[model samples]
Target: MEQAVCCYRHQDRETGVRCSRCERPICPECMVSASVGFQCPECVGQARPERQAQRPRTMTGGAVAANPRLITMILIGINVAVFLAVQAVGDSLVQDLILYGAWPPVDPTSGVAEGQWYRLLTATFLHQNVMHIGFNMLSLWWIGPGLEVALGRVRFLAVYLLSALGGSALSFLLANPNAGSLGASGAVFGLLGATFVLMRRLRYDSRPIVAIIVLNLFFTFAQTGTIDWRAHIGGLVTGAVVAFGMVHAPRERRALVQWGTCVAVAVVIVALVVVGTYRINH
Candidate 1:
């Protein structure tokens, strides 16, 4: 009767085959075939040293890859940098003085004093305090990656710029003649709004995002400290409209339609600003 083959590593029974690297008898289970011959578990471990010696020393270079969140961070950095530069050149009080902090109706009598016409858009990027910019940037950091990945850079930028414009326009329309406001909240809100639409279209779970947006809206109206509810509302509405239009438009007609829609929105916003300016001046 033939004896049963045993594992060479175990050494409890008859030899099945010899280890390839080690010429030792191995059971079928323990036998490991290598290029030269069957190898035992011990031989495999020993071979690792030789393999390691042959491999390249530097597994990865020192250069770090950029994280997707970096873009939003860079933007926040630029804003802070600008603010710091402003403070360094002028008094700390000057930061508040020039902050896109102008009211509507360029005050013809006062000769459009202090707040310049360019501030409408510029102000949206400025923040009053560290807490203000910090929170806004935090929101951008949390939400930007997903939107940027989904929409690609160009569309994401468009959404942001247009939303900023929308927010500024709303502020122009609804703000008190003398009230001045500045912050990235409007554009941030627009990003939230756009993401909300995109997520819904992709059939992603949007309940959490929707809840966040609603809460922000509630806070916009509920909180009393320098919140520009008009800008928030305007950005929200404009972002949703732009997102809907972008997503729903026919693919073949997307470029033409989007450009046309943007132009039309711009015209309307410009018209509103002009009308408001005239009203304030007259």
Candidate 2:
């Protein structure tokens, strides 16, 4: 006896769906799925801003609260776990995993030249003592969450690993061949450099960052021994390079540019290692 209702947006089409929020007639084509029920376009448009405002501010889909800097936490966990394993195993782990550049002519057993090049990156996970791991982890904790949120998980990881690689390569080139080094200081310095670059890109005052960097550099060279100043400098510069591209990349081609920059950084580090090895071998 009663006539069927037609959608407000499509008068010719009949529908039974109604917007959950406003209780307006809507066709299937005009429906937008919501938690409770379908919504009309008008309701969706009006509710969008409020929904977005309620959501946490994040550079990527994962929020800091939901994931809590998942990548950063994982890295810290790995470092701490490695540190504990080293303590349990004794100094042998340090002897094997520490970065040893070719120039210093380390013992063959040390594995610098027997094609175990992974030390370039692996050394970053090693630490000399409790103080070393403690300080590095502290610095990572201080900077990691903010940087991870800013760069997103993947890009943040790329910067860290590449900076570690750069640190070892430069340490190899500059340090005595037999000089061995280990720690996440390179990666930690990388975060500092990235933060500095991002702040500058966002047109924010970077003097405090500059001041912190200056203090670190002062401590690096100012230290008495085994400081691996070269590694710190290398990581800082490499991180800045990566961050520069990430910050300046065009929104339309951001992923492509960021990924390409990572590849280029890896290539550069590999090239440095090859050249350094060759010069030392000859």
Candidate 3:
């Protein structure tokens, strides 16, 4: 018996129903009902044959699905872990430790030796309050994955570290000489700025992103209470410059150029901080 049928996917024709897999119309006599729907005999055989022919693709997809990058997750975990550790150590200790984590340029006259140069980078991993770290880490979690996917692990790490260092350098130059600051907002702002540049370079729609960044900048200036506007500006500019370099550089030389430019910019920032500190001390 022959029955009128329509295409399963397109539903426009009354011709014999096409096979779910191969879309070949089959008369009732040739159609076979399967677990999902009716499949033509040719389709069933072809499905099996094609599966046998391309078995490797299935395996590769499975492998790709299983192996996600662990580095970003590990960094978030460490940040949270350190926050918890600071909490355990108590509040007064946290204040002192946080101050220690901040980068204060060496005073040339008093010869105030720099305690820890690593603080330029490490301070970015610390946050002033639970709410502060929570928000920053959340932003990192949301944006970090996409960036890591686009730029790969090494480049992503470079962008983050350079941005942090840039922020620290700015703070050391512009902040009150006796004051100390620590937070991940600088690095987070860097990621935000880099994202804008990346979207623009890719010719992706950027209206929403521009609005968000503008609002954040407005909020930074509006809010008082020890907010480090200088650090935010520094990190944002550094991230944008680095992202621009990456987008323009040749594919093979992009990573090298991006990293080199970031390092060079960081050196210039450090020099400026040193010069500023000498001027202040003298």
Best by lDDT: 2
- Model 1 regions more than 4 Å off: 1-71, 91-116
Each prediction's Cα lDDT score?
A: 0.69, 0.83, 0.67
lDDT of 3 by residue, 1-282 (tens): 976676444455555566677777766666788777779777777678876666432110111212345556866887888778777887654444442212344443222224345556666677768898898888888877766656656667677777777887777666655566677778778888888988887899989778877988898899745677877887888777776776566656755776678778878867856665555555
Task: Report the candidate with higher lDDT, 1 versus 3.
Answer: 1
RMSD, each candidate, Å? Answer: 11.8, 5.9, 10.3
**lDDT, candidate 2, 33-84, per-residue tens:** 9999999999999998998778763442223455757888899999999999
**Residue-by-residue lDDT tens digits, candidate 1, 1-282:** 976766656858687577766677777676566887688878888998998666431111111224545556676787787667665676453333323212544554222233345656667777767798789888888888776666555556677778888888777766765556677888889888988888788888999989999999999999745688978887887777777766666666767776676777777767766765666656
lDDT of 1: 0.69
Q: For model 1, where is the 10-residue window of minimal lDDT?
A: 56-65
Clashes of 3: 0
Clashing pairs in 1: 8-27, 19-38, 20-37, 20-38, 20-39
Per-residue lDDT, model 1, residue 58, is 13
Candidate 2 has what TM-score?
0.80
